[model samples]
Target: MVDSESVKSSYPKSITTSAQDDRGSMEKKQSVQQRVDSFESGEVETVIDKNIEKSALKKMDLVISPIIGFLYLMAFLDRSNIGNASVAGMSDSLKLYNERFNVAISIFYVLYILVETPSVILVKYVRPSRMLAFISLAWSIVVLSSGFVSSYGGLIITRLILGLLEGCLFPALSLYLTTVYSREEQCQRLSYLFCASGLAGAFGGLFAYALEQVHVGNMAGWQWIYIVEGLISFIGVPLSLFLLPDNIEKSWFLNPQERQVARLRNEANLRYLGQQKFDWQEVRKSFKDPKIYVSAVSQFCADMVLYGFSSFLPTIVKDLGFTGLQSNYMTIPVYVSGVLAFLVVAYASDRTKIRSPFLISASLVSAVGYVILIASNSNAAKFTACFIVAIGCYIGPGMNLGWLNNNVAGHYKRATAIGIQQTIANSSGIIAGQIYQSKSAPRYILGHSFTLGCVLVGLIGYIVLLFSLRYANNKRDERCARGMFDPTLTGDYADDFRYFL
Candidate 1:
């Protein structure tokens, strides 16, 4: 996968100094050694690549993308299956009429929010492979147990634990992928993975349709949904533990020379981020950084639509005069559209090395979809709007994840930032779960209006962020022109580190 010859010819080779610069060369060697030591010790910042081969990257995509995507797919199905279950008699069986179903949905986010940041920070101590396997296994157990929940309290408890176990997964996955790919490369990679949520949506509908027809011993169709999905997740545990590589250095697929080049390229990113050593100061630095908050806020808005729509699409479709099974079948196209749009936008963004334009454009598309739903009574218009919203909401999160990954550097700072963003952003899940109440059924004007406002807020936030980043980069350039920029500066704070627009 690592095409050493092609990469060598495409980029300028590093010059080795002769006997004339023996003293300087010695110092340089020591510095490089220190960097390598730091990397091995888990004290160094992330290494970024200047460029990697298309074929080499494609090889990696084949290995990592599908695995990560499948993981997310399972997570989505487990998390959202309750929605489908509710319509299939879980509500009457569990007596979750009125707002009780909403409460059950909202309660998952309480523990989910609490554990997100800390779990991601914990990944720094534990290897990503081990952490991911453990989380997936634990959560699968919880989800399987949920199938047997006969009481409201039992369901609540299981949902809370499910949230806690799943809290670490997304942020951990994002951080793990960043270790291997450059910023520009991350968009498509993230899309490939995130597109799983869309796939999950489509597959979930099919699973719901298929499972609803089953008559298992002592279990209802709703219970079968949970049991089968949980079992599917359990199958992935062994694969992650045995087959997944933790980082490039340890990958079984790469040769020594490729590893050396990858290390060097990543070292440049380490230099940009400043220090590889763990520092409390780095975590505190993220607290003071405005970019992190902006990204988090933008994520918050985007996820409102994502969580709300994914969880409630079946209910909404059922309101359009379809039977329970028919509603599940109808949801396939919305998710399919979303997956297509996400892949296209991610590819374009990566090729152009830009995010804001696509993000803003997609958000506007979602906003218009919301407007259509709100303004129209026609069934065709509403269904078309569903597809538009699905397409639009799915694009922002992947781009924003890449945005933070590219701009934020340092181990603790980046980890903490990701955790914080996920925590704050996912809090929208609570709000989304509660927004589309049964009382507002059929039209759901209030729910549609609320999401419309959310996307607009996200659009405005990205626009401001784009200009502010440009201004910051300009100021850094001005300092460099005056010879006042720090030679030691690296990563995004460095005068030379350009933000991915």
Candidate 2:
């Protein structure tokens, strides 16, 4: 016993728990507390919860991304199926003489533009899930009714209604994503959802191919397209209503602990952004910001290419000497390629935390694609160029949306800004639909050239916006150094906030 006691007195135990570890933990808590104190002081109302676990992030993505993606897939299919219908003899059946087909396409955007802002603003008034479900049902009914349209005038009326409903989807989705995710997480999540457009294109091609083979009852192939797509959308309405959460705190799928984690994450974010309640002042502030208009113009330029290609790719391929079936088949490869490029660009943008470079690169790729389209006579070369155009046009706009969202803050202000952006950008649909006239078959040289010029203009705008963001950031840094910054500023107005260029 005396020997054992002597040995123990001579030995020292290893230190697994140290005072330093406790100090570190306490310091972290203190840091969070300090930030909370600042938030309470009303300097900014947003908070950041560094303690949010990886599992929580995974759960959020799982819950939100796929649902939005699926919804968008259906919406895009319903909207752009008219393109498939065009080559399926819709024009001849409806006696759509001259550019009346184009006029029908153009008319959709008129109502889309008019309703874009109100639809997005409505998301704030009602729950997002309910609003989305109601709109989806409404649009699906309109789409189903489109099959019954016997005349060009009827088609025009259906399209007008379709556009008005569809206008709610994109900008509302954009704003909804902002509510559940942090700024850095948005682009990738958006891309995850945005890949649906390409999927819709691919799926639409197959659907079109199958419908063209059917001749059931009085319905033609184009009518079948609308009927089938509408039915599919109708099936999704209930699912969306059930699955889409109003916000993180209200998510039915998440357990209480996960809900608490989500609430913490969102609360911290709200505090950091300095936003708690809706303010009409923020809405007024957005209109005065030059960045809003610049982003809108930039979107307009990119969409000129997007709507141009999306609205007419099937017809373009058909005009290149392929059968209608073959044209539909050809679209598969283009859209698949575009989806791959879109995912790659989105991932890279999120990883690098840069937006404009990808957008500019995409624009350049599309510009080159358009040049080849205009210059080439070989069908094979033109087909390859179509792939390039698909990649560029689809990918650029994906990032552009994230870029615009990144630059704005506050719930209502962000919604208003996105609404305005969509309103202006969708006008390109009208422009795109009209430009690719039937008279310009085989090689739509004017249409290709116009799209090319638009992409170039967008490229220049991206460059200018890049420099402008950098300039603003530099000025902010200077003001911070001089102690001239407003202490009570929050969100985009906060000195700590910088635009992602």
Candidate 3:
């Protein structure tokens, strides 16, 4: 379905600079040439109108964001619905006693964490539209199969396979968006993606509540949860294959002029669209970068709260003395609060071009919520604390992701960094699964206290990362002022490239 000829025809043969141009103009030309040399495609630059670029951007937002968001929603719903299933009697049906349930939950992350980096690296060769859609379809089948599982061992096998299939999605989606949106524009779009998880949390609750009422044949309510959610997720597979474009060149939604604008936008950020080859050096560079490690640490801390909270919210609520059905519907409001808070913060992040302040604030706010949950015994106070925790839970992880996306430049480097960051961050899922044990029900003092510590630690990591990025920017500025900066330097190493702090 990709228009291969359109890729060739989109750019003109070449653009030549006058030999008689001024010294500054020639230096600029030399800089551009150096950057072009670093890529394999050696594409020529093209002039584009700002108005046309804006129009193209708006079209991209309309066409691309919604589909990916919906797919993520399904992915999250399938994964976190286990919490709902556990509460709805899967625990009893499968004889998931003692640590069996926790093991099933933790097993998903094992393959998930291992496949992330490699799966992201595969996106370039397989293409986004095909890769994303195919994996989604595959996982949907696993989810459908999950409904038929009758034992603890069978449940664990499905979780493992589901983890492998779904692991390809998030990192791939994150990397794909970088190709579409400019650095300053990415956070808002990413907010839409992360917001899907919040929506999933909300929608999953509603679905669980409704499905619990069904008494068809002898099937448990938990089985229906997986079966229905799996069928719903199948809707996205066809939409992704037919509607999503591989890259700007293959974007059927844009006119020829608009395609040029898309390419120009990427070029403006020193991203040579579809030009870069897979480079081992870039992958190695990602590992060497201190920013990647710090960001990974922050992501880990944030995800500890995210995965733990999402997976255990129903249980936590049920322990608050509510019926199982009451617990499912009650968690809906908490997720809605998270989505609202994320939208407000994401808009401000894009407008001001800042990330750390909001990231730190979200972490601190969630810490306070955890404190309230640990210290207070009142049901109303504890429920309010859940809302407070939700407010910051979604924000921290999303902002951290956007922060990393903004700072990294080269395609391979960004891909590797995203994979690495996510791999490390998602390992927290293992810890999250174990922290909220059945023995620690009601108050869940251990889980609450542990998450509180994670929030504060994540806050400190953000502060350190902010200062580190600012310092890098300052160092680049100093080099530029001293005339020691290399005009030929590309990607994040370029003198003009500044980190988003």
Candidate 4:
């Protein structure tokens, strides 16, 4: 009787039953809207019936690219800034008068090579924000510590530490980003990140030029180069902690819907990678895959020329009769040339859905430039050659690495695959550094010759990968035609499973 009386009182005398039901429906709608909003906010990583906003995805890219770019810039700068130092007279001042400079620089690669493949396994387990941000700090310290070297031992030790710390970067980044963004989005994201390396190369030279003018207090120009670049790298560590999100679910900056949108995009990416299960056997299988070997071989070939030229380019410029400041300034144009090359290839590769041909074509073009650089005496010719060389050498990794990404199927495979690619590929740094000694400075014929040979070999290797991928695809197609396999299995297979070619 109290419920009836309360219901009668609560019911408005002016309202009928249908009108009351309308009020209930409106309240229900409001409750549903709240559920949608909660999902959009991504307070939880749960599934719901909601439409993903396309605009939010575009916005997410805007947020993530700069942070990823910073990582790449730092990667390029930390490893190759030593080149700027070489031009600034790192060898002469530190009295690494023997072939110790090459050996010292090469030592970084040993630690780099050892740490590279092993670090990938640890990548998924560690919080990349914590791991790589701390790594950035570690390497920044190593870079700064290089400035304190009064003896050869200190430089070698510092270089090794730099390698040890840097070992976590590119692979960790690839894993983290791919875990969130779709494959279609990956190339452009990767490109922006990689393009920053060219920017670093450009700025690294310019920075070295500015530092050369300030050779004062107790430091040589080269020593100051280390100190300054090291300081510059420190700026990134803090930004990474605050602005960076580890993956989609942890993306605090993104709303729930936006985060789901990110995850949804990568679903195709995941399936293409063969519904990747994170098993050690997959990693072992990745190692055994001949394609991995082929990719690594191609990577190694590319790096021999790339790292060789990078570590020694400044020294080479100095030998051509430019002062330290002049050599540093000269690198600006090369980097500018490389920046354009990276962007063009990146956009075009994604647009045309092509990868290998770009790398092969660029490698050969670069190989031609190396031939002229070694043979030329004209300064104008040499300067123009830098433009060509920059485009070729710098373009290879962005393209080739993207190629590796395109071919790799699962997360574990991609990790081990990229790990092997980097480890073997980076060994070229040792070879490149060793080839161009200061004594051979003005005309390091061997370095030039080796670079040309390696680039050509890389070009050939990419061609081989293309053929191999095509051959595999054909076999699969034939199997489908014979009803040995379901055509449905080939959708992500088509989109997600393209060979590195």
| Candidate 3 stretches greater than 4 Å from native | 1-50, 271-275, 319-321, 487-489
Off by over 4 Å in 2: 1-52, 271-276, 319-321, 488-490
| Residue range 218-280, candidate 4, lDDT tens digits | 788888877887898887788777777766654777787766655654442444444444687
What is the Cα-based lDDT of residue 241 in candidate 3? 91
Residue pairs whose backbone atoms clash in candidate 3: none
Q: Give the Cα lDDT of each candidate.
A: 0.78, 0.78, 0.83, 0.69
Please name the candidate that would achieve the greatest lDDT relative to the true structure.
Answer: 3
TM-score of each: 0.89, 0.87, 0.89, 0.82
Candidate 3 residue-pair clash tally: 0
Residue 26 shift from truth in candidate 3, angstroms: 10
**Winner of 1 and 2 under TM-score:** 1
Better of 2 and 3 by TM-score: 3
Model 2 worst lDDT window (10 residues): 4-13
Compared with the true structure, what per-residue lDDT tens digits does model 1 show for residues 15-73?
A: 23344555876867665455334323323233323244343465667777877878888
TM-score of 3: 0.89
- Backbone clashes in model 1, listed as residue pairs: 43-276, 43-277, 44-276, 45-276, 47-266, 272-490, 272-491
Instruction: Estimate the TM-score for candidate 2.
Output: 0.87
